[model samples]
Target: AAAVGATKQELTLSIAIVSLFSLLFLLAEPYAAMGLGLSDDVAGAWIGGTVDLTGGVVAGAAVVSARCEEVAAIIKMTQNSALGVYILLIAVLASRSGLGGKDAASPAPPAKGEGLVYGLWKKFPKFVLGYLFCSVVASSLADRERGIAVPLLGGVARWWFAIGFSGLGFSTSFRSLREQLDGPNVLVHY
Candidate 1:
């Protein structure tokens, strides 16, 4: 009934709000678990082991303390950050080209290939040098017990995760959403 009466714009806004809320809710548990340092299995165990309401709550908290053993999160975060940097650099180049539009026949592609190589080198060049920076350095200097790299990597990963999320949000707009809502006629499969 609400959808029937609402304007296209209003309906689109409603959908966006609902979708964002749903996504946040869905991610809450995993984010909490990641923050807590508990593996999913350990979190499950803690939750299942407890009986009282407080126990359940504490179990949830415990999950947050469990460190993630998965390397996928770190890799994904790095990939996302690299992608974001590439996009940002492209946007900057596009804007500069647009400003130069009056003087040029067509905008030339920025020397992004060189920039990308240089950027990658600047970002992680030490890895190729065999110098063993960061985690390796910490491990070598402080011993394995003191040099756990997860925390440091996790912090960097979270920062990139935020950048990726922010980039995604920036690309979303009400106009595109309205178009999608109005085009739902195509959604019918029958």
Candidate 2:
């Protein structure tokens, strides 16, 4: 979002849209997959592809079956690998379009031979590598170890998410939310 020069309002809008999409996809995919006589793994993968969050994907898959959870995790992780590329593309487009502000235009364009690969490297999401590394380590563990590790890691993730959310809530001023709520179109938009 920072690379794209999105304001707080745009980030809020993005979150709202993501929430709506996650809800609709979570509710709709299972039944649709069942109607088509798809297996749980396939249905889970479908849900994984649609949902961006790992926890949400796992929850949606678990609604169908326990095995679906594992399948969904793998699929979601695979899907998430593309996020770096997605962000890089967005950054490049933002730069080209001057969406990142006037400073973006001050730099000369890369040589023709330099191409997108060079630019993409500069904007790539490094966190993805960490995710991939953890995934590899988890996969390499013994079944018993993995059984223990999964829940432990999940609990830690939930704690971190809670802390992050609390920080965000603390940082946001109620006055700003109230002002947005006061807008005549807020209700209609919601």
Candidate 3:
């Protein structure tokens, strides 16, 4: 939605809210898990599954145990697999709504026999395939010789995601971000 300029402020607010919630979850998960008498693995899975950020999930689980972090990362990857489907759904809806580049005044509902397959193909999150492939390979290797592959795969995945995030940070317009931060809307939203 933010990419297409649909409710940009709302998207920003959603991001902020999720970030805040993830931080809160990280802080609270351990005590809550202990109170509930949950095992470290279960607690980590719950944290990873619920939190919006993979880093937060990994960090949260790491605070519990290395074994927990491993479980958490895998759960996070599994959860992320659904993102492609979500994006596809969004693309279909957006195409029907004449979003992405079309004039809003004119509706561009798919023509008489136009199938959504093409639009979905165009909008699919292609990185998800790479993620899934890496996950499958990692899982296969992890089941072999003393499970040595888990840490190696996880360390690589962490750096890959970190680099991707760094790219995003580098690409972001600081001036635009400052303007957004300065607005009364930010206060009201908060």
Candidate 4:
């Protein structure tokens, strides 16, 4: 949603974060399974929790096993289910701190002579309702079968994933990356 007008480099950096995490987790899965002797489910849960992003969690878990991928996807989706609550909390906090409802695009509802819900109505995003509704409907329709559920929701996920990477692939300039990586900031970060 926030990806409206960020520069190509900024977009690529966001993409790279997930990509790097996926690569790191994929490489570390071997050690986690062998050197650490963590089971597939446990490793999957760990990746799911740490990766945070849905695409990275799925991709990272795929290296371990199909079962791991399933577990990681479930955990990540579960985590995503709390997005509405997070948004609500953020809106309420922003409203309380007077950080929200100041923008002309989203006018603040009056507080005087109005209920608390009214005050927050201007701050809350309308799309969150759609998100929660879809989650609930999908949860109701969720099946264990790969042929059905995978194509149902997983295909949509993969499509969005592809679109994101495809944008990065097309927009990312090699020279830009080189400059970003060669700066004094790189040395400090490293």
Best by TM-score, which number? 2
On the 0 to 100 scale, the lDDT of residue 182 in model 2 is: 43
Off by over 4 Å in 1: 1-147, 181-190
Off by over 4 Å in 3: 1-17, 35-42, 65-74, 102-115, 135-156, 171-190
Query: Taking the tens digit of each residue's C-alpha lDDT, what string does model 3 give over 1-190?
Result: 4223244344444456566678888888856876888887898788878878877888888877887788889999877877767766776777766565244322344455666675444444467678678767766663664278677867887898889757655655546655666464544544
Per-residue CA lDDT of candidate 2, range 36-109, in tens? 88798888888888886677888888877887778988899877777766777776885566443224322333
C-alpha local distance difference test of each model: 0.43, 0.68, 0.67, 0.65
Q: Between the candidate structures 1 and 4, which one is better when assessed by lDDT?
A: 4
Candidate 4 yields a Cα-based lDDT of 0.65
- What number of backbone clashes does candidate 1 have, counting pairs of residues 3 or more apart or in separate chains? 8
Give the runs in model 2 whose Cα sits over 4 Å from its true position.
Answer: 101-156, 166-190
Taking all chains together, each candidate's TM-score versus the true structure is 0.28, 0.61, 0.59, 0.58
Candidate 3 minimal-lDDT segment of 10 residues: 101-110
Candidate 2 yields a Cα-based lDDT of 0.68
Which tens-of-lDDT digit does each residue in 80-153 have in candidate 4? 87877887886666556555333344445446677557756755667678677666766776465544764677
| Residue 110 CA displacement from its true place in model 1, Å | 23
Q: Which candidate is the best by lDDT?
A: 2
Give the Å error, residue 5, model 3.
6.5
RMSD of each: 13.9, 6.1, 5.7, 6.0
